[model samples]
Target: MVTDTDGYIHLVQYLTEHLGIFENSQQQATAEDTVMELFEAQLAAQILLVCGQNPSLTFAQRNLIIREVDSIVYDLEEIFASVSTDKATPEQTMFITEFSGLIKNLFDQEIAKLHLA
Candidate 1:
């Protein structure tokens, strides 16, 4: 699992950076949605991986974690939605997507370990 929280902070920073000027609001909205979706997926995967790693966790504990993750992500979405995307660098956007995938792969590795063990 991705134990470091820096990835999450960087995601927020990259997303807050202004994006390319869109031809229309629809285009901008789509770009924002894509970025947010990838971010949310990464967050969920990391949290789930951590919860899964602890085999001793009770059902209620697992459920609590899931619910907390969902709540936190929802709050972040609201915050990110308000950030203006007037001029984002391509590198920042690319990094967000790529980093998200990398974290997810880490989570996947943890799952594979569970099965193999």
Candidate 2:
């Protein structure tokens, strides 16, 4: 799961440096929600990456990918539940929820491809 973690870290850095995920949302977000969203985005991005790269992997690799991605997503969901107590600004909530949905959709699209693989 080193690569998975690295992908998450990379995503965090990319968001900080390029996309301004943190900066854009911080004003509207609770500290916890911002962090949670980062993890969510990382999980989604890695799922998409793994699904896209599935062809290079063996059956074992596919299973590993599924396990790792599922684990990360599960962990994020748990964290989200815990931090969800804080209320965000309406604008921030909208941004976070919509963006979260978009990432989820992206992940779903990629995961769907796994069946074909």
Candidate 3:
């Protein structure tokens, strides 16, 4: 099976190819890869949210996952602001805003799930 990072890298490559996020493929391993890491946390948060709903994990395990996800959320927010949209067209900007909002909502929903669990 592909590792999470690898899977995300491929997804990023696909997006970059079709979406024109960066100038070249060489950006894939450096800048674009970091963005992939940010989204990977979304997956982790979601999995933990589902896992936390089960009785299999002890309180300590659930808490650990929650803490880690909280840290990831912090990093995600930090990097989010570092990405520039200065050169984007109005339509591109709008699409990015919509996508970012969707991701933010998903992460927020995971936070709520953590609380409920």
Best by lDDT: 1
lDDT of 1 by residue, 1-117 (tens): 223356555644654563332223343343434545656766666666666667766677567556655665675567656443333334445655565565555445544555676
Residue pairs in steric clash, candidate 1? 18-87, 18-88, 19-87, 19-88
Best by TM-score: 1
Task: Give a tens-digit lDDT track for model 3, residues 1-117.
Answer: 111234334433544554554233332333233443435544464555456556565678567555654554554455444543223444443444444444444444544655687
Best of the two (1, 2) by lDDT? 1
lDDT of 2 at 60: 76
lDDT per residue (tens digit) for residues 3-61 in model 2: 24444555434433533333334346544444555556555665566557555656775
For each predicted model, how many residue pairs clash, with residues at least 3 apart or on different chains?
Answer: 4, 0, 0
Task: Look at candidate 3 and give me any clashing residue pairs.
Answer: none
User: Order of all candidates by lDDT, from best down to worst?
Assistant: 1, 2, 3
Q: In model 3, which regions exceed 4 Å deviation?
A: 1-49, 52-54, 82-117
Order of candidate numbers by TM-score, starting with the best:
1, 2, 3
Error of 1 at 69 (Å): 0.6
How high is the CA lDDT of each candidate model? 0.53, 0.51, 0.45
